[model samples]
Target chain A: MRITSQTTSDGVSEHLFTLDDIPGVIWSPSEGTAGRPLVLLGHGGGQHKKAEGLVARAHRYVKDCGFAVAAIDAPGHGDRPKVERHERLVADIRQRVTQGEALGSHIARYNVALAEQAVPEWQATLDALRELDHVGGPVGYWGASMGGAIGVPLVAAEPRITAAVLGLTGHESLTEAARRITVPVEFLLQWDDEMVPRDAGLALFDAFASREKTLHANPGRHAGVPAFELDSSARFFARHLLEDGGPAEVEESSARLDRS
Target chain B: MRITSQTTSDGVSEHLFTLDDIPGVIWSPSEGTAGRPLVLLGHGGGQHKKAEGLVARAHRYVKDCGFAVAAIDAPGHGDRPKVERHERLVADIRQRVTQGEALGSHIARYNVALAEQAVPEWQATLDALRELDHVGGPVGYWGASMGGAIGVPLVAAEPRITAAVLGLTGHESLTEAARRITVPVEFLLQWDDEMVPRDAGLALFDAFASREKTLHANPGRHAGVPAFELDSSARFFARHLLEDGGPAEVEESSARLDRS
Candidate 1:
């Protein structure tokens, strides 16, 4: 692992690094480098580690929860060399989108291939991230769409992840992996998502064996998830990752309506 | 309107009152009786305004948000006299539960009848409550199951309600009312609810015309909504009601991932 660059802004310190050939970045509170929660972010397809949305979310988690956040480029995403096969797949998907054809099977097959390679990369990244002084507490994973496609498999394989907020891409290929995950999960589904069928999303949510999983469905296309969900996800991570003096204490009420 | 009794406990003042023939209760912060948000809770069937769950929720809203919370007995519930027709309906529903027969249509029919009588009483109660100093700000409604049955119509008919958190019971009968509601809504759906069909619940969420409606579905029976949802709803109300110096400002962000 090597740190290539570093900068500080708005009380958050950003560090860019590479483990072997995998390019990644980590965000933390500049002043406090002690033990704090760490959140790993997986960017969507065609997006890199510091995608606008992921950076914003990382900043919020750092500012609101005082947690360290990190993101890494996928196998052929961001600064990595593009694979010819993935390039062909992307072109085919764009063609299919123009033709208005069903994308479920095609995307599922492609994501399965991506997950096989990316999961191990993420595992290695976690191994290196834990060596840092600021990142030693519980861990969380936040990713959607292709990120979710990778996350479903990673969270299932990695015991270090205690909670996750994953969604957008749900396929039969990932069902088995989702079933193996027992951590608290908050899944997102766009009601009118054009790429992924609605039933497929609901079915994936059902496949999670976690006793505590919540599904948040909103009305919009694939990239149109409302901004409020960011806040909701922050609270979810705070509940699971932070052990003391956090927002988790306020939710321990026994107030439930009588089911008549 | 008359206040028949009053008590203070845990920093919340609970007042039992009657508006004409309708029995009701209101909860508020004991010290500050000035302008604040008000939330109206509708209890489930066979339960009353002061149901244990409703009181707990009222106390949280008052203590946490410094807001007034109110709940009124439906026509045939709480301290009100029972209607013979409603009595027959209750017996029939209990019988169906024993026989394990389908209860969707039966409950919808009964709820439609109840809404007709309850909506006007709720409107009158709102009209009376607004006269109180602490209850003049934006209003929100929280109800599910039978409460949702009544809330769908009440929120649709009353223009004063700016936001709502409703779910648990969904049928074709409430479709039109849901379509008419244009305010922000947070809907709940139980994934394994025995009473309400999952499709019907999804359809109800689809029928909402609000530009900012969200659906939060979880794994459980009809009454198994997770406790975290109560805290989530409190934040939803605070966002829509309190215009300044609240938790709403934290959600404003422009972070989003680019979809490939």
Candidate 2:
């Protein structure tokens, strides 16, 4: 991984990094985070890792909770190489819209194909992140919309993630992924979403095998998610991940390495 | 549909039914049956309705249990028109075999694509079957392997189906369909299957939302499904579907009418 640039202000540090492949941003407690909890934040559809909301969430985790946060662009969603399938999906979606069909199931099918690629890429990125001493910490996942769908399978397949914040996604029964995830979960759903159906989102929540999961539902449209939901999510992750500082004694010798 | 030919033997009648589009066979108790149950049977990969095993199962359900049984060829299996996707899947499987890779996930993806089309066709067939006066009864589904995968979604979508026998199919995690299936399910898993991994099959069974589900696992390869499992399936359907028949009083006028 290459650290493209870093800016330190007050008690938080924002760093932009690219590994010749995965380009992402990492936020750390500027006072010096040796080995702290790492939260992987996932972005929604048509959004990038450094979206304003995600960046704010990262700052909340690092600056407020003394944790390190990172976000990577999922395949075809951000600064990644474009694939034909993504273009095809967009074209198909446009055609379907022209034909006046609801886009939920079509979008779900397309996302399933994309998530199949994104999950493994996230796994690889996680594996790579472990090489950085300061970033080696208990990992938690936070994502919604496309992020939730991708994170569901990612967390299910990767055991390192201990908890998750999933919501704002409407239903496409992905119980296969949800049933395999046993970590504590905080799921958020917009009850009156214009996009995803409420039943499908709840179905996804019901699929999670987590013994402890709280559903955060708001009576707003898809984009009208209540701000309190994020606060609840922050509290959820802090409760689960703030228990221990992993290998805090590990040296920060390679923490600031700049590959470029 | 046209009843191409009919023959009575041992107090049971076998009829070859054909439409210009769909070809299938129907077997029933020959004792002037009009109030018996109807069971839709699906054959495994590359097998036809008249395959020896399917035929035996049909006879078991028809003669032994006094239920009407029917089976139709899937879009590209049996005598139906071949789809390009099916050929591509076969080629992909062949290539994977040449490269010595695992087949379970690969097969699952291919079958998922095929089942997306198969389920709607099965729904149409079910709609047509309801028009047949002598064939109207408590509906049950019996399918194994690829048949199981297709039937899972079919039975889930068609609420008219009261019970199902699904087995030998392993992990494509079509949990969307499985979750919607609330009927009693008899799922069979081959413990030592060479093609599908055991977990995939069990995962498929686990994905089912049925409150009443019995899993029958045998220590055998894919085709090594125990002979008596069919008997168990026959009994399961009998228990669920042998009750009061549905709309059996409708006229037989459309029973033999071929749309072609």
Candidate 3:
């Protein structure tokens, strides 16, 4: 692991790391710990490790919940090398739009390929993080859209992940991945997502084998996912991974959302 | 500069080259040239230097036109580390789609940013290639979409280039770049390009200061461009770069296209 750049903010530190070709950012809480839980965050497709949502959530996990957070770019995303097929896909989609054709199969193929390619990479990243001294602790996950697509299969296979917050994505096939995930989960859903059907999101949520799972459905399009939901998710990981937070913290967050 | 990989087919040799993180592939004819003219080809957005379109053109220039061909991935593309903003832009587009909004601004931004950042990198690759003994000769440029966006500014400023094939992209604001380009040009335009307005493309062509310029309008959307177009582009480069193919050859190709 190499630290290419580091930024310190209000006692929290953001360290940019590169191992082989994998580029990632690690955010450590102000109150550091040797065995504190870590949040394995992820960015949506076409996003890098430091996307606004991922960074905001990482900060919330670190500052509000005292959990260390980290994320890496998915394949053909972020600082990683651009894949040629992705470029081909971009051109095809652009051409299709010009022809006024619906992007049904190409979009589906793009989503499936990106998510499938990223799962093993996420696992490799988990292994790399675990070897670091500060990361020797429990882990959770937070991802949306393409990130959610990847997280489902990842959380299913990665036993080290104790919990996950996934949303803004759904394909019936993804339910199979969700069914294998036994970790505590908090799934977000936009009532009128233009890209992902509501039923697909619900189906994945329903498929989760975890005894502790909750679906937070809000009114809005895909981009309309409420901001407060991130706060609740931060609390969710805090309850599962942190020493201080538990059922009381989780219940309080639900109440706050109810009031909002 | 290093040759990381090499493959031979029939009498042609495809060699992958890398220099300080810039990854490219060079295609050579059966009978190599010590100081052969080299075509600096570029790939479209989301593509690496070895994009199929680019590879096909490179091979055509090498095997068919008898000129050495080379291409380097643009910045934030191929083997180079991606820019952080590109990742953010991608996420923003995905989120926007979920909201069922037009991607006018985001797509425009993505195209602009990728092109602007690529110009300097293209210049550097040219400089690096010039130092190699096998690459000592006149150079030409071939690019489309994001490739053309970068090529306009590059050809406008880089006097080393004698000719260029630029098209499939246009923004009125880019005319300023076109205005400075005085090299011989073969500009291709897809009549019904979905991404670039037809007027923008024509306007950019009109802005070009080149005394020797021709517009090749084809029937099709962006991807509907005919394969014969690439052949013409190769012949254009050969007419300008290869000593054997000169004014007579250029006139012959103009006649060939006229009849077709």
Best by lDDT: 1
Clash count for each candidate, listed in order shown? 2, 2, 1
DockQ of each: 0.32, 0.01, 0.01
Q: Is the docking of candidate 2 incorrect, acceptable, medium or high quality?
A: incorrect
lDDT of 1 by residue, B186-219 (tens): 9999999999999999999999999999999999
For each candidate in turn, the interface RMSD (Å) is: 12.7, 29.1, 33.2
**DockQ, structure candidate 3:** 0.01
- Each candidate: RMSD: 6.3, 21.3, 24.8
**Cα lDDT of model 3 by residue, B165-255, tens digit:** 9888878657788988888887877766776777677677768887666566554577777654665576568767877664234334333
lDDT by residue (tens digit), candidate 2, B154-202: 9988988999988888664676778788898878776568887766775
TM-score of chain A of each: 0.94, 0.89, 0.89
Ranking by lDDT: 1, 3, 2
Model 2 DockQ vs. reference: 0.01
Please identify model 1 stretches exceeding 4 Å from their true place: A245-260, B245-260
Candidate 3 lDDT score at position B257:
30
Which stretches of candidate 3 lie above 4 Å from their native place? A96-105, A247-260, B1-260
For candidate 3, the docking band is incorrect
Candidate 1 lDDT by residue in tens digits, A1-260:
89999999887899999999999999998887588889999999899999899999998788777889999999889999997888888888889999989989988877888888999999999999999999999999999999999999999999999999999988889899999999999999999998899999999999999999999999899999998798789889988988852443312210110010
> What fraction of native interface contacts is shared by candidate 3?
0.00
